[model samples]
Target: MLTISRTLSLPESELVERFLRADGPGGQHVNRTESAVELRFDVAHSPTLPEAVRERLLARRDRRLTDDGVLVIQGRRFLRPGAQSR
Candidate 1:
């Protein structure tokens, strides 16, 4: 969870997870597994985020989010299959 209220970045908390194929130097692991790097963020419901940040998120016309307002990012950029969850 990134804190736009006070910090430049934050870790994962209320993040939505997505697993997909990745392209990296993991030998056969790359082919047999998913390991790249991509993460999505949901601007809604974030804690203490700046108003401008919230507006930016709400401005995006992404359909990846659900009715509950959660954005999904495909994560495959790393040594594994999960996103960094930042």
Candidate 2:
């Protein structure tokens, strides 16, 4: 990974938010893990995203997109918040 901080022109504090959940292929174990990571970015309000990035995100027809235009990314790898890694 290219230094996570250096690779980003914006600071970590500026990132909208990151949600980690358990993604699965582990069968019964899948329900007990939260290894999936979802990135929740508010295209209309995140100060960290460049204008181009914002435009592109909003253009997507995602189920997570609210009528007001908030993008909701869910880490569905695990049904719960804590478990084993994927």
lDDT of 1 by residue, 1-86 (tens): 55544555646765545556665566546577754444566567777456787777777787766556566665444544343333
Provide the RMSD of all predictions against the true structure, rounded to 1 decimal. Answer: 7.6, 6.5
Query: For candidate 1, what's the RMSD?
Result: 7.6
- Candidates in order, TM-scores: namely 0.44, 0.44
Q: Quick one: how many clashes does candidate 2 have?
A: 7
Each candidate structure's count of clashing pairs? 7, 7
lDDT for 19 in candidate 1 is: 58
Looking at model 1, report the run of 10 residues with the lowest lDDT sum. 77-86
